[model samples]
Target: METLEAADMTQLLMESHELSTMINQSREVSDYLSAKRQMEADVEAQRLLALFEKKKEQYEDVQRFGKYHPDYNHISKEVRELKRTIELLDSVQAFKRAEDSLDELLYQVSRTIANAVSGTIKVPSNNPFLEAQSSGCGTGGSCGCSVKKPS
Candidate 1:
């Protein structure tokens, strides 16, 4: 019976360890998804940047001409193009931030799940996680953890 008990403990520990590994692997998947999303967003961003760079000289020319010829029409279009580029860049930044937030949230959730399974942490009551440790009774008597308490 002692051997059987040891085997059960070994199996439980192995399963917990595997679950931890899977959680870590899923975090990597989130990272990969973020990278792919960023790559797609970059295309539009770079196009806008390129437009700004390519037209800068033209805009500068119109600015210099409009100083002498106050009724210049080309200057207005150049200004509008600059605004369009700004809007595109802003859109890219927003997409990147959304992707980053998704990755961060996924990582936090995976870590929480991994800790719950392997750390033997007692789950908090509904609506009580905020103050869970405030009324602690120390470690519960039957903590699944096998670690010895400090002497």
Candidate 2:
């Protein structure tokens, strides 16, 4: 019985590796990689991203002091504006869309695998909308559909 279990585990590992390779070769991944490369190669986008990161760090520092900090409002506004500017870049927008697409595809694959193992198995997702919709807990588990602990 132990030997059979070991064989099954090895087979499962090999199959998972194949699945990973297939996913890596998928169009979603290809688009994501292309968009990422474009974003990285854009000089303006890189500059804006660096500025955004610096402003975001400043915002985090001021956040701890709340509104009482002298630079809080300025830092907050700067971060927001920088973020908006970054988002407006074509390369940044394309990268974000491709990333989201790839994320959704991976999420679907995870959900399929989990459901195959057991229908009750809940698959965690990066997208909040997917988590709520896929888990049948549309109301965020307030309707008594929450997972129960085994007694």
Candidate 3:
């Protein structure tokens, strides 16, 4: 029985790796990679991103001292403006959309795997919509909720 269980575990791991390979070859991953490459190759994007990071650091430092900081509002505005400018870049926009698409695909895969194990199993995701559903004590019996355990 132990040997059979071990064999099953090995098979499951192999199949999971195959699934991973398939995911890596997916259109979402391809688009993500292409967008990332384009974003990296964009000289303007790189320059703006660097500037954005510098402004963000300044903003963080000012934020640490709260409203009392002399340059708080100015630095904050600069950061926001830089973020807006970065977002407006075509390469940045494409990369962001591709990233979100890949994230959604991974989230769906995780949810499917978790659901196969148990409907109540929580599937973590960066999506705000999915997060709203998982907000409470996840119905997994371990949470000490009034929800009944799956049979």
Candidate 4:
């Protein structure tokens, strides 16, 4: 039985490796890698990214000490503006789209595998009641009570 289990594990590992290779060779992943390289080569983007990181560290340090500063808000806004500027670049946009596509694909694949293994897991859908419950309103006298039933 132990030998059989080991063999099964080995086979699973081999299949997983092949799947990873296929995903790496996919067009979305290739585009993402190319865009990442382009972004790395961009001087202005790097400068803005460095500034954002520095500001983020400062904001986090203030938060860690349980103190709020106007500078934190200012830094946050500046970081957001810098992010928007960086996102406007064609390479950055392409990278973001490609990354999102790959993320969505991976999510679906994991969900499918989990469903198969667990016999249709009760995953949440976009139902209003479920949404209300997930949004922390399941109590009888809470906002969930205001949700009208489907006629």
Candidate 5:
């Protein structure tokens, strides 16, 4: 039984590696990489991204220590505006779309694998992955949906 389990694990790993390779070679991934490179090379985008990161860090720090800072609201607004502006860029928009596509692909693959392992598991027909992608509520937090616990 141990040897059989080992063989099954090895097979699963090999298949997972193949799937990863396929995902990497996909157009969405290629586009995402290209857009990322372009964004990195843009001076203005870099400046905006740096500013956003700095403000985000400050906000997180304030929240973490349970301190009320008068600048919190201002920082939050600035972050949102910066993000909106960044998203308006063609390269950034392309990167976002590619990222969402890749995310959905990965989520679907994971769900399929889980369902295969546990035949009793059933996912609703609403395409939760795509819904989450579109809603832009990644992983968790205020999505009005219960978070799934890992088994």
Candidate 6:
């Protein structure tokens, strides 16, 4: 009986030691998981911050120079080429006209404004063209509508 009791105590002690070791290992695993999660969150935050910075820079550039806007790329390119051509030209008036390049811009702006006035944003008054009963410059006056005058 004494030998059996000794053997039982030894077995219990071994089991207790194993249980404590498992508990310690579980704690370590928990710590490791927590660290990994925090690292992932930190990496995600940094990624978002970088994305925000890039977008902010683009926004600032667009605000500072209107040509940087996404919608202005093609028009801006055309304008730049036009300016270069005008610079090469020997005539000053031609250069001025190219530099102004106001026709297309004016048309687009006017069309957008007209659409807004007619649909989304209401204006106090209608456009003169809308009020006019006849088309084709009825008064025989220079009613500039998509005119491309040569300088």
lDDT of each: 0.57, 0.85, 0.84, 0.65, 0.69, 0.46
Model 2 vs. true fold: TM: 0.85
**Better structure of 4 and 6 per TM-score:** 4
* Regions of model 4 farther than 4 Å from truth: 1-7, 64-70, 119-151
Q: Which pairs of residues collide in candidate 5?
A: none
RMSD, one per candidate, in order: 15.3, 4.8, 4.2, 7.3, 7.3, 32.5
- On residues 20-122, what C-alpha lDDT tens digit does candidate 3 reach at each position? 9999999999999999999999999999999988888899899999889999989988888888999999999999999999999998888777767676666
Whose TM-score is higher: candidate 1's or candidate 5's? 5
Query: What digit string (tens of lDDT, one per residue) describes model 5 on residues 21-123?
Result: 9989987788778878987888888888888888788778666644367776776777788889877877677777777777767667766775566633443
Point out where model 6 deviates above 4 Å.
1-41, 66-68, 71-151
Query: What is the overall TM-score of model 3 with all chains considered together?
Result: 0.83
User: Model 2: which residue pairs collide?
Assistant: none
The TM-score ranking, best first, is: 2, 3, 4, 5, 1, 6
Against the true structure, candidate 1 reaches a TM-score of 0.29
> What tens-digit string does per-residue lDDT give for candidate 4 at 29-90?
88778878988888887887888788778767766644366576666677678778878877
TM-score of each: 0.29, 0.85, 0.83, 0.66, 0.65, 0.19
Q: 1-151 in candidate 2: lDDT tens per residue?
A: 3553345888889999999999999999999999999999999999988888888889999999999999999998888888888999999999999999999999889988877776567778778877766665423355777543222
Residue-by-residue lDDT tens digits, candidate 6, 1-115: 3553334888868986886576445644455455445544565444544555565555555656686567556545554555454344334333334333433333334445555
Better of 1 and 2 by TM-score: 2
Error of 4 at 96 (Å): 0.6
12-103: candidate 1 lDDT, tens digit per residue = 79987886677556745565566556755787676766777767766676677666755356666776867676655655656556555555
Using TM-score as the measure, the top candidate is 2
Model 4 residue 54 CA deviation in Å? 1.3
Inter-residue clash pairs, candidate 3: none
The Cα error of candidate 4 at residue 142, in Å, is 12
**What lDDT does model 5 reach?**
0.69
Clashing pairs in 1: none
Better of 2 and 6 by lDDT: 2
